[model samples]
Target: MTQLNNVGIIKKANIYFNGKVTSRTVLFPDGTKKTLGIMLPGEYEFSTDLKEEMEIISGKLEYKLSGHDWVTIDGSGIFYVPANESFQLKVHTVADYCCSYLNE
Candidate 1:
């Protein structure tokens, strides 16, 4: 990933998932958005309307893309999810991550 500097006009957003998950959205200057947040230890299923690249910033998580087997990812690791698809994540520890939405 390329370095992003001069991110102008940040807006904070909170996303809730039935009290199980919460993520803070960070808006950048060039219309790119990233969510920096933590995921509690549990199993979660998520559907996305846009393509996303999820990077593990701290801790670890095991995730499975649709029709795929689960794989573990650590800090600095990334996984991609295509648009209109769903994925599952099983977290054993409190995982910190950044989800970047990819604009087409």
Candidate 2:
């Protein structure tokens, strides 16, 4: 069975960087929000204090939690990030990912 959405897209934001980086944010229902970011061949960081993070959509990414060992994650994977922790995502090549978090 499939469910159809009755509401509309609340808010959307897009940013194109000078390099090969780009990002976008989409707000959905039930205080759920999604952000898509494209990174070039470089390192980046992800941090938050909120505890309710849902999933991540990625093409290819290398992540390190609190300066731990680098973990490579490709394609699509779901992850639950702990609260009050800082994480980093290092882009080896052209990588894009979507992060779903609680908007409230």
lDDT of each: 0.81, 0.61
**Candidate 1 residue lDDT tens string, 13-81:** 465666557777776877888887788888999999899999887777899999999999766588899
Q: Largest TM-score belongs to which candidate?
A: 1
Show the colliding residue pairs in model 2: none
Residue 101 CA displacement from its true place in model 1, Å: 0.3
Q: Per-residue lDDT of 1-104 in model 2, one digit per residue for the tens?
A: 32225434435446444556666666565656666667787776656776545344556677777746877777766555666777776666676565656534
- Worst lDDT run of 10 residues, candidate 2, spans 1-10
Best by lDDT: 1
TM-score of 1: 0.83
Model 2 spans > 4 angstroms off: 1-21, 52-58
Predict model 1's lDDT versus the native: 0.81
